[model samples]
Target: MIPPEVPLDDEELVTRAQAGDLEAYELLVARHTASAYRTAILLGAGADAEDMVQEAFVKGYRKLSRYRGDASFRSWLLAIVANETRNLHRSRDRRTGLVLRAARAAPYSEAAEDGAVDAALAGERRATLVQALRSLPERDREVIVCRYFLDLSEDETVAMLGWARGTVKSRTSRALVKLRGLLDVEELSRG
Candidate 1:
C-alpha cells in the first residue's frame, strides 16, 4: 500500500502552481490568507482589507512566473498585499495618499490585556501608540509595523518592503526613536 501523502512546503507548492497547478495555488492561498489579511489591515487597507487580500492573491497567481523565490512565500505574498493596499489608498485621494494606520486592535498585544482599570489604562496607551504610528512618515510607519507589530524579521521585512536590508535597519532605528519621542510626549501630556 502507498504511504499517506505528505503535505508540500511553499516552494514545492509554488513550483507546482507556477506549472499550472491550480490546486497547489489554492493551498498556498489557504495557508497564507490570515497573514495576508493581517498585513492588509496593519498597512491601512482598513475596511477594504479582505478585498485587498483577494486582489493580492489574484495578482500573486498571475505574477507567479516573476516570483524568483528570493524571499519566503509569505513575505513575497505580503509584498503584494502591501502594494495592493497602497494602491487602494492611492486610488482614493492623492492628497491624503499612503496613510499608514497601525492596526488599532493590536498595541504590542497583551494584545492589550488587563483588569478593569488596567484594561482601561492599556486601551488608552494603545490608542496613544496607534495615533503616534499614524502620524509617522509613511516609510517610518511601514518598517515599525513590519518589524514589531507584524513580528516579521529583518530579512523578511527587507523582502516585503523591497528594500535593502540596511535600509530596513536604519529605518527601524529611526522609527523607533521617533515612536519613543511621541510616546514620551503623550506621557508628559497625561501627567
Candidate 2:
C-alpha cells in the first residue's frame, strides 16, 4: 500500500500527469526528489548521479502513460532511478568501483549530534559503517541499501531490484549477515 501521508493519490496524480498537468508532475517530483538524490549520491558519482536522476525523471514523465499502477508511483520511480544509476556507471566503465562505493558509504547525517564527543563518535561510526559496506560485494550492498536504508518491503525490494522473491529472501539474509559482521568489527575496534 502507498503510505497514507504521501500528499496525493497515485491514480489521481497519474491521471493528471497524463492529461498534461505540469503541476501534477511537479508534485510527483517533489514527493520523490529526495530519495532520487540520495540514491544518486550514495551511488558515489555526484555529477553522474545528478544527471542520472534528471534523465530518469524525464524518462519516467514520458512513460507515465504506461504506468500500470500495480506499484505506487514512488516504487516505479525508484526503479527508474536505480536502473539509471546502474546504466550511468556502466557507461563510465567503472561499475565495480562505483558499486562498491555505493554499497560501502552512507550519507552523513548533519543533525545527528551537536555535542563534541557525540558528534565525533557519530561521524566515526558513520565512516566505519561506510567502510564496512564498501568492503562487501555488490549484491550484498545493494540488498542492504534497498532493504534497510530505503525501507522497502520484500515485495517492493524485489520489484526495485528486479530480483525474484527467492532471490530477495536469500540475498537480504546474506547482506544482513555481512553488515552485522562489519558492525561487530566496529564494536571490537571501539572496545
Candidate 3:
C-alpha cells in the first residue's frame, strides 16, 4: 500500500515559494491564514482584519526573497501581518475606531426592542475596550493580545513573541495594569 503524502514544513514551503513556486506560496498562505487573520484582528485591524490579512499575505509572497529565516516562518509572517495592520491604521489617519465586526452585526431584533439596546451597549463596551487596548504601547498590546485576547498560554506566548518566560510574565502584568488605567480613565471622562 502507498503511504499518504506528508505535508511540508513552512521552511521548505517558503524556500519553494522564494523560488517562484505559486503552489508553495499558496500552501504557506493556507497554513497560516488563521494565525494571520487573528493577528490582524488583535492588532487593531478589527473589521478590516480579513482585508489586512490578504494584503499581508500578498506582500509576504512578493517579499519572500528578503526573508532571512532568522525567525520561524510563522513569526516572520506574523511580523508582516503586524506591519500590514499598522499600515491600515495609518491609511485611515488613525481617526476611526475599530469595530469588532461580530458585535456590530449581532443585533437581530427590531430597533425598539431591548435586544437593540443591549447590542448597542455591548458594541460600545467592545469599542471602548479596543480603543483602550490600542492606546497601549506596542509591546504591551502585543503581550496583552497574546495572553488575554488570543488566550495563548505562557509557553506559547513566549514562543510566539520570542520573549523569555520571565519577560512574558512581567510584561503581561505591567500591560494589564496599564490597560486597566486606560479603561478607568475612559469611564471617568465619559461621565
Specify the highest-lDDT model's number: 1
Q: What tens-digit string does per-residue lDDT give for candidate 1 at 27-91?
A: 99999998898888888887788999999999999999999888999999999999998888789
Q: Total clashes, candidate 1?
A: 0
State TM-scores per candidate: 0.90, 0.81, 0.67
Sorting all predicted structures by lDDT, with the top scorer first, yields: 1, 3, 2
| Clashes (candidate 3) | 0
lDDT, candidate 2, 74-156, per-residue tens = 77888888888878767777544333345345544665556777777777777777778777887777777788777888878
Answer with 2 or 3, whichever has the higher lDDT: 3
**Considering every candidate listed, which one attains the maximal TM-score?**
1
TM-score of 3: 0.67
Model 2 ranges with Cα > 4 A deviation: 1-7, 95-114, 186-191
Local accuracy by lDDT, each model: 0.86, 0.77, 0.78
lDDT of 2 at 173: 93
RMSD in angstroms between candidate 2 and the native structure over all alpha carbons: 4.9
